[model samples]
Target: MAEEDAASKRRRLGQEVPSGGGVGEDGGDPDLIGRLPDEVLGSIITLLPTTDGARTQILSRRWRPLWRAAPLNLEADFGSLTLLESERVASQLCKLLSAHEAPVRRFSLKCNGRYGLSQPIAPLLQSHRLQDIQEFELYVRGDLPPSLLSLSPAALRVLHICSRPESPLWTTSTLSFPSLRELTLVDVDVSESALHGVLSRCPVLETLLLDNIRARRVRINSLTLRSVGVSDCGYPWEARLEELMIVDAPLLERLIPRVPSHHLVIRVIHAPRLRTLGYLHDDIPRLQLGTMHFEKMVLVRPSDGMRSVKILGLLSAPNLDFVTGLLKCFPCVEKLHIVSYTQMIFKNDVKCYAPLECLDRHLKKVQIINYEEKRADVNFIKFFVLNARVLESMKFVVCRDKCGAKWIARQHKKLQVNGRASQRAKFDFEADCSRGPSSMVDMKHIHDLAMDPFDRSSCRCHGDALH
Candidate 1:
């Protein structure tokens, strides 16, 4: 009896006591993982990627029932996948989900199935098993039956749906998804009022992303909202809304927006926490980021004029007046970045240029790309070095051939003697010019625009991020 008691102690804590006795006569060692409680083991299994997690069932009898203990965290990628393979994967998910006894925690189905076999899975979307779903992402080609996504939205935390232009999710009524935190939508057409209703409903929403969306106008109002991104999101010339307004959001930190046509005006007011702003690589008329305490901001050289910008980014600094006028807005910007360095032929030389007072105390970093070794361009850079008291690093990027040894040596000596206000400042070497879509880091925020935001012409950056 004492020997049997000792053997029992060696068995896994959660393992069922064997009816034959303490030890399986052929045993080598007890399963270490079996010692953990069932719920704890379930959680460990949940952390694995979809396939590896599901494959664990074959390991032993204990894990066979564990897969069904928690609804599968199944994610199927079908975007570039072949139609037959994608359909097979989708079919399996549908079958597994329908037969699942437990609730699904997360489900992601993505693809543009060319074979049109996507409709058979519509019944799975309406399953009651999704009641416990915490995250749901669906990026498919055609219209999703409205009944398919009729979940209460209360349990949802992350919702990303990119549907067809013809049939979008109903934003006409107040969408009650108070628990939703991140929402991404593409190609959803809705009226301005309906869009407003959706925002008003999601009480705790933090991130909102829209791509190729249709709306007469969008007016945002949220106390808990943090970030908003819009690219190619309005109607054409004669039909666009008068303005896209952000009425009030206290927690908003980063805003990168783009509009389809040049006629729409984007406005922001009462949003105090806004820190990052830009990606004006389009023909939108104007953008107002708010009135008070605007600092540490990323900016674009106002196509309209100088009074509109804080930290100026230029395709071309047409004249000295535009530069000075821009500095006058936020004279102490810490970092200044220039993307295109082509000299613009000024209409006329102006005598009025304001001195920048904020440079000596605040500006520290500056990066210039597509830099042409023009005399005036050198002078513009020299002014910043001479005036920036706290200046730390200055960088330049040009075409592969432009930064020859002689050219770099010439500019190095020239700027050194030009007299830097900060003694410790250093210059970084020029980077290679990358015209390829992959190298455009600054353009990352509004990447969808490069893919032809107005139409379905394929944006490479769509699947990755809104950085």
Candidate 2:
């Protein structure tokens, strides 16, 4: 009977216990992972999902106590679950929470349907065990519980809330989070007062991202914030960031804006340390960078330009004249990124636009996304290769279907790489084969937009994938 039990134990651990029941029988080492200290094993359990972590207790007698002692990371993802399945999972999670011995460390619950709001998510979140949660993320279809806003502000460092309803998630008049460093709000309806309260309260916030959020004319005023991203935010009917005023953000560095579908107006009143800014397209009716102003990307009035900007992104069909005019405004730019789709006739000569400050001294790296290799695109590539004296590297992210060794060689000849002005410049051709369409501003949150947000080498270059 005892021999049979040992074999069963080995089978449960995915190991073959020979009839001899000795290490030499299989000529393999003993269970090394099973010999690890309880503390290390407990730490590993805390990193797993709630259900997975709990289920680990069934692995063996050694693992039974480890799970109960480890901190819990509760993740209830109902994106794939049906309405009934989601409710059942929610109920199971509540029971598991009641039985858990340690405090919850990270909580993430995302439900796909409207039935998610009807689930008993409030009770689970409001439980006393969740007060010490350090990271909280919730995405549901209706208003959130008041207790959600009242989580231990001092303990929480990250907060992500996505409300799918038409009304605002924050029904309370007051909202505060003194210790929060990163905040992401999506599809939430917020009033001017609530917006001010949220921003003003999170004094230590470093990153803030608002996506598809509904609010009035947005105004950002912060001291510690380093990065801010806003995309398609407005009233329900229009659904665009109508106007954004960076009134005062002394420490701000990166301002990433994605407006592929709607028009936006931006004004920078005071941000001395701002360095990275972009995805500024022709649809932007007006843009003010300190004393300089642009109407539909055309410089209207000019004083001393914004020299603080180093990285700039332009999304438009290839137009050299429009590009040259914008470059003249930010003369000290080091990295120039242009994402163009339309192929137009190349009229202006590259020589005519010579003596540009960026090309002559500052510009080092250039990236052309969605390179379709049209006649105009070829001419555009030739312009940079023949210019940009200090350029170090140029990358052309081509659609997968349009890229190959022969095509690349043809492009090299057309671009006249041999006669390139910059001797040190290395050219790289990447084939983007991602399923979805590539985006100029590819980021989930503001923090994801690192120092070089325009660089696509890090991500899978889904250059021009057709859905």
Candidate 3:
């Protein structure tokens, strides 16, 4: 019964199912999926899990050969494989690859301890057909086969290597990925010289990401690289040896280090067309952006000597002092996005370290996310209401989990009575309401307020847009 239902669902989805297995309401060959072209069938197999992809062969004799022609995307996570199981699985995988007529497009090998370095890994590495692979990932706790690093395909584009915590990644001084575009490394140590050596070889590299990896100095000199992110980097933001330096990358667009202002000391040695940057801390090493004038976002921090940035996003607003100090850093910020969550609220009245010049003059758009009826949240919005003379549109996104529809209505009323500085200013309230806009507010939303008119694209990201 369940089989017939599944066949019907597939038929509705425009997929041909086997007929003799079960008759359709019209009674004929219930067009079998095998009738589809090999390319289309291969695509369908790709969408299934690796196990399910193999299982399709059992559906019928015609389906048996379909899995063999599909591009192989095999991931062997032998972390939990017992010694015997490891040997068996590795043997089977190698045997499967040996007979595979189709190209192996993606392969990932991860081990809990000793599985990656075992003899079985060697056979797979020497398969020679590896030259056809495009995406290769390795996460191992112990030493990797020497052939693995040098075994990458000339056509490989994505390479992610997470090495053991104690040992540095030991690629030969001659090692490089000629066709590599995106590289992600975690918990691997690489000396500055080796790091530069590997990077110099990849001319078309686009994105370089590092997580908890130790490299005293990382110099990106690629012409094609567009985005780079380093999070929870090896050294603390204050370490003398810790420095993130980018030099002569003309197409560099996004340089994002998820580490907080209190955590990174970034120096753009030189990037000509750089677009977005973030997490500029107060304690960063003396930095320079070599006349590459591109609008970038700055995370707010107290007394940061940061300059030449425009946007500011935050998750926590400890006090108005933090806000005041932030405005002082970027005096002419053209755009902003903020949220009214309770953790952002301060316990007492706050003082500004210096006069805030942006909100009084140049500040334009502001978004408040997770807004609630709590007084602390309202006060945060109220601060912007009375100030921000040139403000264009202020958006408040209220969540049902935080407050009910009734409380959100009252909060909007409170803001309108507070009086905004700009005659052209508008406040938009985006919330999940019950009925019509009238169910929330028809006349008020139109004549006075523009409820839920948020154009998300104008912002960098919806939730963590700036932060």
Candidate 4:
């Protein structure tokens, strides 16, 4: 009789009862009550959507109360539905949570509705029953009410807050985050003092990312901060931060202890912990350093004229000579890459320091991209080919256009057959350089007086005599 009654309940619940199975064949359906443990059923119900959870009540009498007891997940978008409809959905979600005894683990609310003077957010955040909330993500297209700033910090491990162009909700004294490990502020206009106040308070913060965070001046004094990234922060600001990165910071002037007095200072104060140093700017007058031990470095400038004082920590510089007398700073440099942009001239003055004899010998490889057969460029190349005994290969990347392909091909043939006792120099010319703008030369063709004695191509790299 009991078996027959259980089968009847499975059939009523629209669940299939496996034939020749145990007495509780329909127990696989967690919604079937008395057949499975309540905790197991509650876990299964929590995974269902709010709408689906409500629909499960119609399955059986036991299932009617499970949806209310299960954890709640509320998701609503005002863009698709009317504002009233979205609020109605939120109200139902609140009611469901109010009835539940277990703590809510995750609360995700994304709203695109405009909140004017009439609408309030207290009802959404006043869930005292949600004690186990681990993740809270609030993305509001409109302004956030001041009430949201009072959320319980103990229950939230990760908090992401994004607001549209609206007034801030908290003042510097009122803002507080005690237990946050990671914090991201996006498109939020908060005063510099308020921002620093928040960071100074969050003692355990590991990573802080600021995107489009407009502030007059930002002062960072976090001692435990491991990583910091600031992008598009309008103007000059004093930041005493470690492991720092500044991108598109237009008005940035000074970085703590100004440029060094003498010597190229690249000190890897922490090489094992440092990775990348990327800076892009319109003009950089000087780069002073006490100690910089970064593994990788990248510098992007508007024009080649932007001067850089010294780069001591890295192995390569594309604009080595153009950046003033700083190339000799990296005496320990193992690899060198020189990039020649369009209409950009690479002048080789042997009298300057005999770069071919001095610089190439220490380098393991020399890569010249967009190589043109101008007299100066060729002299620099030949110097590296003959002097760099440790050079394993010299890669001359031809631009996409056929601009310098002919020149590279001719140069490769000449270097290969010359068979001079110099280390058998290898040249590859299967590259194109004409796809871009015309090449720019730095200085006029080297006069006959400037030609080295060993140069067989005369002062003109094109095998033509000097005019």
Q: Name the top lDDT candidate.
A: 2
User: What TM-score would each prediction reach against the true structure?
Assistant: 0.69, 0.84, 0.69, 0.47
**Candidate 3 per-residue lDDT over residues 1-467, each given as its tens digit:** 75677677878999766433344335555444545677788888865656778888897776778898887877888778777787788789888888977788888888765554456677777787788888888888876666665685788888888876445565346776889988877667777787788888887888787666666667677778877766544344422235567877777755555433234456676665554444333334343566322122234323443344455544444345555655665576656655333444464342223335787888888766566666666666677776778888787665643444666567757765346777687766665322111111111111111122123433333432210
RMSD of each: 9.0, 6.4, 10.0, 16.3
lDDT, candidate 1, at 101: 71
Q: Give the per-residue lDDT of model 4 (tens digit) for 340-427.
A: 5434555654336545422544455544555565665665566555455666556565554442555555775544325422455454
Higher-lDDT candidate among 1 and 4?
1
Give Cα-based local distance difference scores for all models.
0.60, 0.75, 0.62, 0.47
TM-score of 3: 0.69
**What's the TM for model 1?**
0.69
Q: Show model 1 residue runs off by greater than 4 Å.
A: 1-49, 52-73, 78-88, 98-105, 113-118, 233-242, 259-261, 280-283, 289-320, 341-353, 401-410, 430-432, 435-467
TM-score of 4: 0.47
Q: Tell me the lDDT of candidate 2.
A: 0.75
lDDT of 2 by residue, 181-243 (tens): 888887887776677777888889998887777665788889998988877742346654577
Report the Cα lDDT for residue 436, model 1.
20
Q: Rank the candidates by lDDT, best first.
A: 2, 3, 1, 4
* Off by more than 4 A, model 3: 1-37, 59-62, 114-116, 233-241, 260-263, 279-377, 383-402, 413-467
Model 4 residue runs over 4 Å out of place are: 1-76, 79-81, 99-102, 113-120, 233-274, 279-467
Clashing pairs in model 2, backbone N/Cα/C closer than 3 A: 432-461, 432-463
Look at candidate 4 and tell me the lDDT of residue 261: 11
